[model samples]
Target: MHNEPLAYRMRPRTIDEVVGQKDVIGPSTALYKMIKSGHVPSMLLYGDPGIGKTSIAHAIAGTSNLPFIALNATTSGKKDVESVVTEARMTGKVLLFLDEIHRFNKLQQDALLPHVESGSIVLIGATTENPFHDVNPAIRSRCGEIKQLKRLTQDDIIELLEKALSDEKRGLGREKIRITKEQVARIAEGTNGDARKALTMLESIVIASDEEDGEYLVDDAIIEQMIKRVGVFGDKRGSHFFNLLSALQKSVRGSDVNAAMYYLAHLLENGDLTAVTRRLLVMAYEDIGLANPAVGGHVLAACQSADRLGLPEARIPLAQAVAEMCLSEKSNSAYRAIDAATAAINKGQVGDIPAHLRDTHYAGSAELGHGGYKYPHDTPIGSFGGWADQDYLPKELKKAEFYKPVVAGEEKKFAGIYEKLKDFRKK
Candidate 1:
C-alpha cells in the first residue's frame, strides 16, 4: 500500500504543472489569478473522471500553505464536516477539499456551510456530476463560484505521460525503460482524454514489457495488445457506456466513417443492443431527417432485425446501417424546424388553430364557421392532393415559416417544392 500507483505519484503539485483545462487554470482566469495570490475561495470543480479534480484541489491547498483537510464525501458525514469546522477555528485557516461532493446529503453540506461562510475553511468541492443539478443548493450558493474542467486533449495526455515516464521522484524514470512518442500518443488516445487511465495503462505496459538483455523494450506487439484490451476489457454497462454511445452518434452525424466504426465496435463489444439501436434510431431522425426521411424507415427495420437476430449476427446489419448513415448526405431541417416552432410556442408567439383547420364534428363547430373549411382532395393545389393556399395556420402566425430545407439527400426535391409554394401562399 505504501507503493502508490504511477497516477497517484504523478499528481501535479501546483497549477503550473496541471495540463489542459486552460479555460480554468490559464493565467488570465480568476482561479489562476487567485491561486497565484494565495487568496482562493470556495469553489466547486465538476467534469469528467480522471481530469485532475483532486490535483487542482491539492494545488489550491498547497498554494494556501495552510492546514488542508481532504475528505471523500461518500464516507464523510456530518461528524467529519463538524470536525473540519472545529479544527478550522483552531488552525486559523484551513482548506477543506471534498471529493464527490454531490454524495454529501443536504444535512452534511449544511454542516460545513457556516465554516465556509465564516472564511475559516475555504471549501473546494469536486464531482463528476453537473453541479447545478446535483450539488446541494445551499452549498452551491456559498461555494462563490464553480469551475468546469474539460477533458485532457491528446497532446495534454501525451505530455503528462512523458513526464510520468521521465520523472524520478514521482514517475517511472528509475525503471530505465525507453518509450517512443508514438507509443505515448497511442496510450493517450486509447484512454479517451483520461490522464489517470492513460498513466495507469502506461504503467501496465511498462510492467508487461520484456527485459531484453537488460534493456526493457516495449514493441508494437505490446502496444497492440494494450489497444485491444483497452477497447473491450471493461464493464459493458459502466458509466463510460454513455460516452461510447455519444461517440458513435456524433461520428455518424459528422460523416466520419472510421470514427463511426470505431465507436460501433465498442458499443457492439459491450453487447448493448437496445442502447445502440435506440441512439442510432435517434441519430437517423434528428440528424439525417428531412434530408432523407426514407432512411429513417431503414434504420427502424435494421433495429428490429438486430433485436430478433441477437449479437454476433446482429452486428452485421448494424454495421451496414452505420456505414450508410455515415455516407448519407446530412441535414437537420426537421430538427431545426421543430425546435424553431417549439421556441415560438414557448415564447407565447403562438395563436389558436385556424378555424378552417379545426374539427367540425363538434355540435357547435359547424355553426361557428368551421363548415367553410375547404377539403384538400376536393380542391387540388400542390403536386399532392392537398390544399396549399388555405390558411392552415392561425392568422397571427400566417407568415411564420419554420422549415427551410437544405440541398442534401432527398430534401433537394422537397426544398424545390417548398420554395416554389411558400412565397405564393404568403401573398
Candidate 2:
C-alpha cells in the first residue's frame, strides 16, 4: 500500500505466486517434487539477474518450515560461514542461502563443503555466473544445480507486468493507474525481457503520473522517455558486460571476422583488455581447436606478452591475436571430440588404456613385459603392423569420428594427413 518499487512489492510470497521459471517450478519438475516431498537438497541456482533465483530460494525457505539465513558472498567470509554452521548445529536444519557464490574464492568455498556434506546446513547458493566455469568443482558437486534461463520473449515480460499490475498490495492498482496493452508491450521491449527493469520502469511511470486527476494513463511517450533516461543497460549492472561479450562471441561463432574484430576493438576501447584477452584465449580452444591448434598457442603467447608489455603495447598483440583467431581456419572439432568422449565415459564405457601405451619407465618394468611393445618407427611405413588397432575408442563410437576437418587453409593439410593415415591403416 505504501510507496515502494513494484518489483519489491510484488515479490511472490509463495511458490505458486512466483511468475515464470515454469521449467523449474512446473508440476513433476525436480525442485517442485523435492519441495513437495520435503527432500530438498542443497542447491545452486544460476541465471541472469531478476530471473527469480533468490525468489525461489526464499519460497523454499518459507514453505519448508525451516530456519533460513542469507549471506552475501561479496561481504561474508569463512568466519561468517563457520558462524552459520555453528548456529545450524543448535537450530536443527537450516538453509544457508548465499548470493553471488561465485565471488567466494577457493578457500571460502572449501570452508562450506564440510558443513554441506555433514548436513549441518542445507546450502542454497545463487550465482549470476555459469557454475560450470565459476564455481569450484567440489562445491558444485555437493549441490543439485538449477539453471534459470533469461527472459527472451515479449510474452514472458507481459506475464510479469500483468502479475505486478494486478496484485493490490504491490502493484499500482490502488492508485487507479490505467495502462494500455501497447504501453506494457513498449516497456517490455525496452527492458530487454528483464522483469525487474520492466516493473521498476512501470513503477516510476506510475509515481510520476500519480495526480489528483480522474485516472493516470501510461502512453508510449512516457515509456520511451523513461527508457532514454534510465538507458537500455538497465538497473542490473552486469548486463552491459555480458551483452557485449555475447555479441563478440556470436560474431566469432558466425565467422563474421570483421564484426568480431570490431567488437574486440569496442571492448579494448572501454579498457577491457583483460576480458578481451581471456575470451580470445578461450575462443581459441573452444571454437578454433585442433583444426588450428596453433591458434591456441598464439593466443596464450599473446596473453603472456600483453602481461609483460601492458596497455598500449599490449593492445597490438591482443589485436593481432584476436584478428588471427578470427581469420584462422575455424573448427570446433576438438570441442566436439572431447564432448563425445565425455558422453561415452559417462555412459560407462571407460575401458582400460592399451597395455603397450601403459607406463614402462619404472624399474623392474621389463619383468612385467611393460617395454616389450614394438616401436612404430622400427617398422616399414613407420607403424608397428597395425598395433595401434587397440580399442581406445569406445565400441559405440568406433566409427563415430567427431573431428571432420573443413577444407580451409591448414585444415586442408590435416585432412590430407588423415587420408594418408587411413590408407596406411588399411594397408
Candidate 3:
C-alpha cells in the first residue's frame, strides 16, 4: 500500500464507492447488474482522463471476482496480446482490459477479435476517442460500448473532495488538514468536475503546506497557486473538441463567415489540424451539399493542401476554404433529400429506376426497350414532360425552396441559375 501512488491508493474499490457517472454507474443500470451478477460483457469505456474509467474497470474486477489483466495499447503489441490471451485461456475465465484502446492499430485490434468471440476473455477497452470513428468496426462490433461522461458540475467535484478529506488512510485526513467549505468548493471548482484531478490537487496542497501542530489549514489562494501550476489544457479527450467543432459548423451553417473563421482559428491555436480538416469535409456535405456542390471539392482541396504544406502555410488555405463555405449560400436541401429517400427505401418504398435514368449502354439494353425512353438532353427545353417516375420528394419539399442566396458574390449567380432551371422545368 505504501508503494502505491496516492491516486491508486485512493482508487474506488466498488461501483458504489465510485463518484459521479450516475447515468452509467447507477444501481439499476445494466453495468451495475452485470457487476452484481458477475456476468459482465466485453465493454468499451470511453471518457476523459481522471474520470474513473480505469477505476471503474478495477472495481468491476474486484466485484465480479474475475482475473483482471491490464494492457496499455501504447506499449503492448501482438506478442503481448497473444501472451494475455494464452494466459486467459489457461485460467479458463479472465477479463482483459485495454486502456487507450484507440491507440491500437488495426492489426493489434484484429488479434483480439477471435479471443473475444471464443469467450476465453471478456475484453474491456477504454478510450478517449469516439469509438465509432477510432475503433475498427470489427473490434467495435464485438463489445458493448459505454460512454463515461466528463465531470461538468461543481457539486460532483465537491463530493469527491469531501470523500478525500475524510478518507484517513489515503487522503488528507492523515495530515490532519483543516479545509473550509469555501476552500473545498474553490478547489473542486478549480478541478472542473474531474475527481482524480481534485484529489491529486488536494494532496498537492497538503504536501506543500507548512504545518503547525499537525494541523494544516488550506486556503483558496494556495489552491489557486496549485491550479496555476497544473494549468488547464481543457479536455483533450471527450466532446470538448466536438463541441467546439459543432459551434464552428453551426456558424458556417448559419452563414456567419466571421464567426466561422474565429472558431477555425481557435481550433488551430489549441486543437489538431487533421481533426479540423475532417470536420470541414463533413460540413461541406452536411451543410453545402448540392446547393453549391463545388464547396465540397474546395474543402477537400484545402485538406489536401494543408497536408502537403503543413501548419502556418497550410492554415492559409484552410482559412480561405472556411470563409468561402460560410459566405457561400447555405443549403441542406440535397442532404435532406437523400435522407428522405433513404428512409423511404428502408421502409420498402423503393421503386424501379426511371427508364431514361437506367443504363442503355449494355448489349441487350436497347433491345429490351430501355433505349426507347425519351432523351431529356435532345428535347426542346432539355427536359421531356412525357418521361415518368414516382415523385420521390414530397410535393411540399419539391416546391419548398431551401437555399436562399445572400445576394452577394458568386451566390447571386447561383440563385440566377436555379431560377432559370426552375422555369425550364416548369416549361
In TM-score terms, which candidate is top? Answer: 1
For model 2, residues 80-184, the per-residue Cα lDDT tens digits are 987887788899768889998878776676667787888878988898777777777788888875565555467878888877787676776666778888888
- Candidate 1 lDDT over 203-222, as tens digits, reads 88888898876666887788
| Candidate 3 wrong stretches, greater than 4 Å | 1-3, 106-111, 232-243, 251-427
**lDDT score, candidate 1, position 409:** 76
TM-score winner between 2 and 3, please give it: 3
TM-score, predicted candidate 2 vs. hidden true structure: 0.61
lDDT of each: 0.84, 0.74, 0.76
Query: For model 3, what is the alpha-carbon lDDT of residue 218?
Result: 71
Give the winner by lDDT: 1
In model 3, what is the error at residue 103, expressed in angstroms?
2.5
- Candidate 3, residues 30-111: lDDT per residue as tens digits? 7788779878788888776778888888888888888889999999989988888788878987888899888888767667
- Models 1 onward score TM values of 0.79, 0.61, 0.65
